[model samples]
Target: MLKISEDKRDTIIAKLKQDIDAANAYYEETIEPAVMERYAIFHADKDYYRKMFPRLSKRCEITSTDVQDTIESTMPVLMKTFFGSTDVVTIQGADGTDEDSDRAEKMQELINYELQQNKFFMKFYRWAKDALITNLGIIKVDWDREYKEVQKTITMDAEAYAQYRPQAEAMGIKVNAAETNPAGGINVTYTAQELAKNRPRVMNLMASEFRFSLDATRLEDADFVAHRKIVSIDYLRMQGESGMYQNVEEVAQKAVAPHYTTLDTQNNEYIDEQPNRTDTGRQKVELYECYVNLNMSDDPDGRLTPMIVTVSNGVILRCEENTYERNPFFVLSPRVEPHHIWPETGFTDLIAQVQHSKTAIIRQMIYNIAQGNDSKMAIDTAALVDINDVLNNAQFIRVKGNVSEALQPLPAAQLQSWTFNMLEYLDTVKENRTGITKYNQGLDSNSLNKTATGISIITQQSNQRLELIARIFAETGLTELFRFLIKLNQLFINEELVIRLTNGPMKIDPSDLDGSFDLIVNAGMGAGAKQTNLQNLQMVRELSTQLAEVGLSGPQQWYNLAKRIIEEVGFKNVDDFLIDPSQMAAQMPQQGEQETAGEDSKTTIRSAITDAPWQVQMQFWQKLGFDVTPQMFTEQVAQKVLSSAADAQAKADASRGDVMHDRLQQANLARPRGGGRMAGTTSNAGAQAGGSTGALEPASQYNGTMAGNAAGSTTAGVSSY
Candidate 1:
């Protein structure tokens, strides 16, 4: 750390303070008003309605949920699209060497593992939701090192203690107590100082807590950016002890000086509805972690270098040059407008006007209906005995004078059909604006009456809108987040990392990830598009099989197709379904042996097919694109059938059924009774008829016997039929 003179330090702090105050002022004056309005729309705040339509206390004040509905529905789609698989992020090696590929795989695993450890799903949910509601969502990623201590008590001999003390003390462990035991060994109690491992930290900052230069379009181009947080005084002291800060006593003293809570600013006051903290005897202070480019006038080049400074209550806590060489914040917006830091429109923004119009219309409609149902009467008070009698729903009311003259009912205005028609029109307008509709949401009543082709087209167009948002997020913020994490891991996490994935454990060394790697985002398209892709892949799979017979496609092509299909279907363990082509090729016999074995294999295969059940044989031939029967099983057809089956079997293994009986018993216990009968179960009528039901024919496949009880419920157990 460079030791700075008091005057120079003051000059730097003043410059940062000036920049932060100006940025905050600009945000409070301009951006926050719109953000607050959007939040009110999202929550459907009654005050927001009151502000819109003033002094309508007794009238209908119902607010529409258009904003909430749009945001909520879109969030699940975006989340599932990004995180549908284990490999949310992938890296491709630049050189394409085996070593580089392996390193890239390990690096990708390490990045994903770090994200999992940080509970990134929930963080992303919040971040994306914020971006949808407000125009921008921000996240900070940095390498954090904090102390972790554990206390341990152990019994050991004096010689063992002597051997351990030096090593333990070198690691900063403190010996609390040591005493001789009755059995001639020492019982020692000590607080062990664990290794200070550097790990990546991800924090989702509210739009209010972050500030940047007003003219900057991106974080990297900004001259100043700061994150404001209210931290405890003790946290500052800890930083001093960790040698991360200078002038601890002065900084703590300055922080203790009374100041407004960091979140109490006008920009952040309505950011969230949270209770004020009661006195907890721990002093709290506002801390600004600012990243800025400071020009040291003494330098001859006069270039501005990126630096990080921590300040609180006009006191500098820590200052150092930025070693990471880039900004740590990643921003997300559903749509990016040209020449703007935040998008001009958000999901809620698009629907805000619709919600307002709908709410007003609904309130008017209900008010009109209410008035019509309880009509006001023009009663002659002088002729009526009591006014309260008219208000009550009484069968007959006594009037002092003629009944017809004293109590004439006032005619209420009848609501026109256009009132309801207008509401529907507004809903249609909303659907058009947001690309969310009752049809796509599966809520339209008339959707079933429409042709399947029409419905599919509508769904496809709607999905295209959502897919654009997903792609924008994937190509921008998500990519930046992974890139930032990769750089952090390379810089701070020098040692090997051992992470356990779903498949198995992997050991990754960050140093091995030295070469360039391109990021591969695994964002999924919408469900309809995915289904289309799956269909295409299936068609390709069939084509690959056919080509395999002619030597155009082989086991490698088949394995690749199977791998893609399995991944698209959301399966991670490809090995469970398909054998690797390399392994299968290695297992093949030599040319001489294969020639002899081919004849023997064909004879055995034909015998097996002949003995198989007629249903199985028919289905097998049909799957091969052949409509065949027992009469069609000639020698010429058998040769073609055997050749196709051999190729298919070589590429992939058919999965065997693995069921646990204990789990089945548990499921049976949980299953409710007195419902539909299980498959292969005989009914009471069949039991009384005294013959096997056709349902029992399939029991031969599982080698199970079904016996009917007195209650006519069949019990299935494993036995030869």
Candidate 2:
């Protein structure tokens, strides 16, 4: 139990309230309005934005859902474009550790594995994409072990030990002070001189160690935020201010600190709002879990002070300096603000004007329907008992003569036409503001102004806007989350673990890894187009094959290029679709050919040796009747055999390249062709030089025939795939 003085208690509570008051002030004024607006839009609650409706008309569902529809329709599209297409997270070592690049890549794989196993990554993306207007994202670490079980000890020296009396035969470290040595250690003592002389010799110590264990865990946001939080530009700063402790090292390894659960019990500040529960306007705070980090401290290093304190409300429940092992939680402050530069507002802010216009149109349409036409009406004000009843119902009232013509059911054509025009105008405003439109959303555009060039420009703009938001989430939320993962792994990983990273298998010890990694997120194409990547890959592949025939690149280079294309296409494991070079080498027929060539060369050499007089010849003399010596015969046979093998392999590769290039070209041919689109231009440079000589064309567009393609052949025939 902590011994807290009353005065200190009052001070801490007062300071907490002061901070809360400041946060609340910001929340009530700046954050609340935008947050509330976003909330209403999400819930489709017409009443929330009903105040902004036209004064002459009541709020209508059709007008209120305008903003909601725009937001909802755009959310899935943005998510599909970003997360749907981009399925890779690449972590590369930027601090010049390419020697261990594979290790870092494996760590990335491990993270992805760990992420999918526990983290709400996709779920969070789905939730955060639309809501990105207010906050970029809320990333939390769901680790295998948020905290470890640790034993702590309390040790007292000889003087304190001798003076201590045993209250219990055996005991824990926690007991009342009145009980002498309540930790229950037997007192041991000796004369000062005798102790000094023999203490080392006897290996006897008077010091007593009282040990106890505690459960440590990471903190949730509720552990710290007792009052409402303001998630503005200052929110992270406010969180930084909340950290307070005694002497525990700020980045301490094993120092004793209070676990969030312990602090929560002491403070009793938790109010659980079930996250999965369906409700509107629920207050949810994230990134405010300071106590989780406070739970971690350096390993009781003598340099830093240890703390054991708990509180309830503003009052201190307990504050002690008892020795204990602390939890190991580390969180990084986000490097980028998630609010995406619009700190004062969000997605709803951009839609507010359009929403008002939509509401006015809806209200006018309502009036048009109520009045039965778009013409002037002159009904005597006193002719009806109730004007509202006359408009809404078929209630008849004593009117000045016949009131039927006065209530003209004017032309429906004008009413319907104008309402639709207003709707179209409002939709255009929404499309411009949000960068979401019928074209992008897969809805056909009815506007006469849409052209291929114009639609193309709008498509690019929409993609860029979504790309910006996705990147904001990536840079701030995902990056910070990765930092936290690296920190935690560094602190807690004890041994190497083998993980089959998406590319290949690798072994990694997270603790051994440095945290200087550059995160490369393949956010994929913001436009739902995969052709550009495929086309570029095909071109590169062709270039690589051509380079190999010219001896510029080795076989390994082409193999690597192929692997890259497979991965770029979003294949998790490339070996499935692509052949492994090692496997191909193992299956190759080069071994048998070398063996056969060696035997033939040996036969020729033996024949040359035996051809000379029934004796082992020291040297072969190539003169008179024998044109070749034994060595010459061997060289000739070896060169001929190896050349055959090399020539065969080259021909096989050339044929394969020709087939693949043709297939790719055909895929292009299958698509609707247009100018400025990447086109395959034929170059006979390689073909004419090395065309169809049963060897790879080193410079031809068609990688066939080192002797040049057959004269007058057009493009390589496309396979009817």
* Index of the highest-lDDT prediction: 1
lDDT of 1 by residue, 94-149 (tens): 88998889888888878888888899999999889988888788899888776578
- The whole-model lDDT of each prediction reads 0.73, 0.46
The TM-score of predicted model 2 comes to 0.52
Badly placed stretches (over 4 Å) of model 1 are 55-58, 86-89, 146-192, 256-281, 391-396, 400-402, 522-524, 550-552, 572-576, 579-721
| TM-score computed on alpha carbons, candidate 1 | 0.73
Per residue, candidate 2 scores C-alpha lDDT tens digits across 1-721 of 4434566556545654554445445445554455555656555455654665545435244555666676667667555554442443467787756556755766666666655555444555544643443432222332343323233334565456545534322332332233235566433431111111100000110001000111112222212222112122233233234443231222122222222222123224553324332422232322121121122233444253344333323333335452313322212111233422224456666777677677677777787675664455456566555666556656455565567743544354346777788788878887877777777776774644677656666566666665666565555545555655655565556666665555566777655465567777775555444545677789988888788788998766777777767755666466676776766787667887886687567556545543454223323332222222244233333433443554565566567788765665555334431222111112223222222111111223333531242353322211000
Backbone clash pairs for candidate 1 read: none
